[model samples]
Target: MTQTVDLNADMGEGFGPWPMGEDAALLETITSANIACGAHAGDWDVMAGTMALATERGVGIGAHPGFPDLQGFGRRRMQMPHDSLRNLVAYQVGAARGMAASVGGTVRHVKLHGALANMASEDAAMAQACYEGALSVDPDVIIMVLAATAQQEAAQALGCRWAAEIFADRAYNDDATLVDRRLPGAVIHDPEEAGARMVEMVQAGAIITASGARIPTPIDTICLHGDTAEAVGIARATRAALEAAGIALGVFPGRR
Candidate 1:
């Protein structure tokens, strides 16, 4: 089992007027913050504000780019050519970098958001395209990818800096994909349940699927979705649980 891991959360998802998630509270609990770019949910104001806040908290900033579906909160899937997907990712990541720079922070990582991420997890070609876009912007930027999926495969194939990630608030399929949101028990709302599962999975150095199967992998970081209603509680609980188990939390030292 790894002695240390990084805790990250999605943030900066709010648009101009309507805010989303508890970024303030979640920042207090997480070591890394994945801020959404404009095409997905955040606007320039939100991105700049979130970037400044993350800088103040000394949290590692990540560029989170999703499909341009603000109405769907980037949760709705979209079909696009690989070239378009790559360009989309590049644009978002570039924006994130510029915003972070203005805020006296830096984007150290990149994470695909919503449906785009889900799709990438299943398609190496697609994942490769997004990653290529990010790398074009900053080859040193760490790609945080869903472990044991095509996302990871893409990163490894590219030989770029990357981190393997697992969810703290979501259940995993036996094949290592996330269970669909439409499915019952797909999203774990209880802090205790979420925290306990994280501890177990981290200790096992694998993803413990809903079917009770374990898929071995190096666990570099754990994700807690900030949009979840129980996000704050789950974040706190997960941090405490990992600490109690003698696993330190800090920024992930991305792998090659």
Candidate 2:
């Protein structure tokens, strides 16, 4: 079992006057923040506010770049040329890096969001394009990849600094892909249940699938969604559970 791990959550996903997620409350429990860029959700003000809060809390800040699908919250799949995908990621990541720097913080890592992430998790070429784009902007920035997926494969091929992440509130299929959100029992809502699952996965050093399959992989971080009150509770509980299990929670040491 890994002795240390990082907890991260997606935040700053609001646009204009609209708000999404309990970012402030989530920040109290997570060690890293993946702030949304304008392409999917969030504007300059939202990004700045999120970055400031993360800086104040002494948490690692990361860019969460996704497709330009604000209406779908970037969850709708879209096909595009690999070069365009690269440019898209680069633009969002650069914007996030600047926002963080303006607030006396820096983007320590980059994580793909929504459909882009889902697509990349299965397409090594796409994942590589996205990571290369991020690296082009800042070679030192860590790439946070979904553990045991093509996202991890791309990062390994690039030989760049990276972190492996697993979902704390989502069910995984036998193939390590997330179960469709519309499916029954796809998203775990109970705090205790989420917490216990996280502890079990960390201890087992693998992702326990919905059908009880365990796929071993490096678990550098656990991802929690902050889009709802229940998610915030789960985040807190998961942090406590890890602590109780003697696992230190902190910013991940980007791939050794």
Candidate 3:
């Protein structure tokens, strides 16, 4: 049987006069784009432009909501009440939806970004709060969750449409969490290596940890970071490799 999976990337992470990532090039490679909401790394104009490009490329659009810490690029953790977290997610998703709609696109999924995503992956309650916020606005929006984590647990508990994601440029810990970025070789920069690893994981239908432990989980999507030229290369390479391996690349069915 031919295997199919969605290739996704976090994009639109730029402010005025300062652009981040190769979004235009990535739109050509990825099947889905997790666009940054205004709070963490984007503004209305950026969102609209990115969404328009994705629409033109026939890519699936997803909202990437994170903490309000723009300075830290939403990579720094900040404590917030559960209610506040829910509202924050809701507001960002709504803003993304509006921007996408203005560009004749619609948000098909929601993925928490940066520290918020890392935190939620460890705390089922927190993941539930964020997913609930997205659901409140669009009940059919697919929630992208880290495979085999609390985020997945929360989605299953809610019985909402969801998809599992794995990282293409990141090394994983034995427990399935990402390796600390501070560690050497944690963030992979080699395009061929990244592409090969992605093919291996997708074929295994599991997350192969750094120690070679295969953690079985649904591999619905492969996340490629587009924060740099090398990252974009990795994305393209991964897509090519998947196709060469006879794995079909397309938008995930999600839960709907």
Q: Which of the numbered candidates is closest to the native, going by highest lDDT?
A: 1
Candidate 3, which ten residues in sequence have the lowest lDDT sum?
173-182
Using lDDT as the yardstick, the better of models 1 and 2 is 1
Q: Cα deviation in Å at residue 250, candidate 2?
A: 0.8
lDDT of 2 by residue, 124-152 (tens): 99999999999999999999999999999
Q: How much lDDT does each candidate structure score? A: 0.95, 0.94, 0.93
Q: In terms of TM-score, how similar is model 2 to the real structure? A: 0.98
lDDT by residue for model 1 over 1-256, one digit each (tens)?
Answer: 5499999999999898999999999999999999999987999999999999999999999999999998898989999999999899999999999999998999999999989999999999999999999999998999999999999999999999999999998999987999999999999999999999999999999999999999999899999999989999999999999999899999998998
What is the Å distance of residue 87 in model 2 from its true position?
0.3
Per-structure clash totals for the candidates: 0, 0, 0
Can you give the lDDT of residue 53 in candidate 3?
96
User: Candidate 3 clashing pairs?
Assistant: none
In model 3, the runs with Cα more than 4 Å from the true position are: none
Better of 1 and 2 by TM-score: 1
Q: Candidate 1 has what TM-score?
A: 0.99
